[model samples]
Target: MTLLEWPASPGFPEPLWYWVEDWHRLLLWATDQAVSDVTLQANQPVVVERHGRLFPVTRRRLAPAEVYHLTQVIYGDNAPSQLAGGQDIDCSYEIPRGRADLARYRVNMTAVRAGRERGVEITVRTIATTPPPLATLDLPPALRAGLVFEQGLVLITGPTGSGKTTLLAAIIRHLLEDPHAHRKILTYEAPIEYVYDFVPRVHASIAQHEIGVHLPSFAAGVRNSLRRKPMVILVGEARDAETITAVVDAAMTGHLVYTTSHTNSVPETLRRLVSAFPADGRDGRLADLLEALQTIVTQRLVRTTDGRRAAVREYLRFTPDLKDAILAQPPARVVAATRHLVREHGRPLTADLDALREAGRIDEREYRLFRGLGTQADAISLPLPAGPDAPEPGEADGPG
Candidate 1:
């Protein structure tokens, strides 16, 4: 099939192109706009997300035929067959910019019913070709140090678009750069994001696999990694009971396993993982999980005062005492115990927000928003500054 070429000057004032037929040019334009995501749907204007805000890239709405053609370009000839199976598909899309540069996106294609007609909605998330350095991620020194474990499970948890994958990539980069340890790192992802071949890896070698493309599932990938004799295993997500069990088993057998979860806090992450198992085996599974856990890092991104986003993290490193306490108590008490530890040892999310506020790194309104501190004075341990000039803690927009 021949791909359509976009006009040199395309936008308002020009004829409306109901079909954005040039995928490469559209993607290139999105890349130049620093778009984090692009959404294309039949009968809807093409939209792009930048800095957590969505805006239309073009005023013209796309047609169903255009969406189908784009999907074919993205997924090749097999797209029609795959879509006929009545399930969403995830894949990676790339546009070559120059001899050395490429723009990559993680694409999700789903079927949508427009009355009696079946249409498609495509959402593409931009990914950096190279992972950022660990130091640049603003992680605490102690937490960074604790991530370099030989045998244990380290989980990075956060909501979607919270930069969990970016943080994990940085951690993997750190491990690859270590001079003393010659390690074999194996990673399993739905669609592989970062490419480490360009980096100078003298001591470590990395092998990345895609979940549906290279392996059947995350659980199968984890089980397969064991036979490959890898020192570090990276599971994109411990999303289901089977995958979680596989990760635990891999850690138990003396491999360092890293994974992500869609949870907001340490205790909540633990609870979610334990809830994956049946009630009869939850306690025992929770105990085993606690024993294998090395760290739980929960991250959030807030708008900085300078008009950029900065990471605010709440992490808990498992010490022997804390692990023992977690094992002894029921899962119901874990949240309270975790809160006590956050007050005493770990840095709580509220404290991080407060510090940012005190340093003037973020505005008072944003501070209160991210901290979830309401008007009730006693609701929060650290009270907002009290004065006539100060804005009321409750007088702010919704949380970011």
Candidate 2:
């Protein structure tokens, strides 16, 4: 699809194709998050580059007839103009940022149906997102470094909007920054959310392919990376049997593969992946999965009193004991085992929540909800050291 070369609206700061910040502002002026997920894709006329990324700014409004004209102008006579009278229209359009110009924003366009009549509104979601740094992951040092070095299936398990993609991005960025490690990184993402910022390598090339835009699914992307001669492969999310099989296969082939799932706990993540196979292929695939399994980290976002949010996380670093249990296909003991070890020095989510509560990093109610505790229960543990180094309650490091 091609974004059109429309005349820049004279009001904005830069000549624009489209931008989410614009939409966010316009939505506040328009109806405040009333727009649907479908949108017209385009490029901004302005070039704003930050840390190796060009953030393209674009905008759109409910002009169905103007959209038809715009599409025909960009796509010529072969455009889907005929579909206008057909009720609901779905397609992508782009403006050729005047040739020799590399587009930072690849706008995706689709029409949302509003009953009998369809109003064309262009919604631009993140085609590529540059996430925060790896050091900011706040992970245990063991998990932060050990996860990338292992040549197995390391999974970050979390529900939607739980920072799984950001975690994966941090891990990939960690690998990319190591000087001696020259590995081709291949990624397959549904909509390709997180974009890497800091990559340091002369020969290391990272290839990211989107699900609908590049290949069909995560399975296809994983299989394709095998032929691309990759050292590191990242699958955005392994939510199905096909994707799970492809990721496991990629790991088993002596490649460092990373993927994620929507499980709240380590054992649950293992069981979810293993059980993705049919009842017939369950045992064999379970063994293969266990053999390739490296680590699982579960994450959740909790709000502080000031309205800012932070990631309270837990990790199950794949050890001999854990791997043995997984290989045996008895997954119930994984969380119990992880909790036991993390209490010593390793960080568990419960422990983190308790710590946050005790330090007033999070209040008792917020901490309890995150700990899966009700309002009536006291989830905060008043644990601290006794020396001058000991921080006071409701304070973590710098004063709250």
Candidate 3:
């Protein structure tokens, strides 16, 4: 069926036909709709994700040939050859709008099985042209203070799609905007999502390199960043032993290093970092890590009462006493100690959730959801504010 002739569908504008044939126009339209991600699969309707909700952008299913052509258009002729080896490929795509303005996307191309035949699924994530300022992100003041450390390792930890990368970019932007910030910052990103050249650099200079494209690996990039004499280094992630070791060593050598991990809590992040090393010297490595860790910010996006999402974070600033406590205690008990210290001194995730609930920013259901309390009747037993506006148990809760 023709795009115009198709029946009306949800989450898409009525004039969708104008851009179906042109992939670039289609992407531009999606971006205008505030779509964070777009998915195109053979024999399936185009899907778009906005505000953590997914919906079909069109009523018509895409043909196999259309998917193939779209992939080639986004990734060039070698797109098919790159996918021929049956492994997923990650890359970046951009469409230049003007001399310096462009719309960038992080793309992942993978092969899918479609009823005995092979098909392709391409996922595109839209990247903001400029990083959002810290003031606009609704971060707590305590967390804000952690971003200005002169030397040590700072980690932004969260699950996938939890805005970890965005938070890191904002911190980098914060440093670059400071009048007295004369530090040189170097970042190693896998696909290089955000660009900082648009921001006027008063005292800080930034150089961003992509993994597998500019350098071999995150470890190699960190080792190379030292030679460039940068005061601050942003490693995209510390997933392996080599990369984690490099980041810790960089922090020890007096370079303020920033990185991310896939853990959901501050204690879990510390455990994951140390666990990356072999068991033979895990304790020593953990001690070294504790000595160099300056801050840990673990965050998750929770649904707000206004049909949007807000960041709920648990963070800790490692003081000398906290570091000593961590090093002196057994590894298993550190998580509990860290939790207690953060609750008493820093902002904990539960405290943030409680504040959000009391301020009428989120409902009872959302608070319970992020807190991991089961949906039993007793789980949401907290007394909600008395009013006609009080939300029922699970009613009116949007996607987190």
- Candidate with top lDDT is 3
Residue-pair clashes per candidate, as listed? 0, 21, 0
Worst 10-residue stretch by lDDT in candidate 3?
373-382
What TM-score against the true fold does each predicted structure earn?
0.86, 0.65, 0.87
User: Candidate 1: TM-score?
Assistant: 0.86
Error of 2 at 228 (Å): 1.9
Local distance difference test, per candidate? 0.78, 0.59, 0.79
Q: After best superposition, candidate 2 residue 348: deviation in angstroms? A: 2.6
Error of 1 at 89 (Å): 0.9
Q: Summing lDDT over every window of 10 consecutive residues in candidate 2, give the lowest-scoring window.
A: 29-38
Off by over 4 Å in 1: 1-21, 373-400
After superposition, the stretches of candidate 3 with alpha carbons farther than 4 Å from their true spots are 1-21, 373-400
lDDT (Cα, tens digit) per residue for candidate 3, span 108-188: 988776555567899999988899987899877777888778899999988877899899999999899989999999999
Q: After the best TM-score superposition of candidate 3, give how far the Cα of residue 269 lies from its true spot, in angstroms.
A: 0.4
lDDT of 1 by residue, 168-200 (tens): 998899888878778999999989988786667
Pitting candidate 2 against candidate 3, the one with the higher TM-score is 3
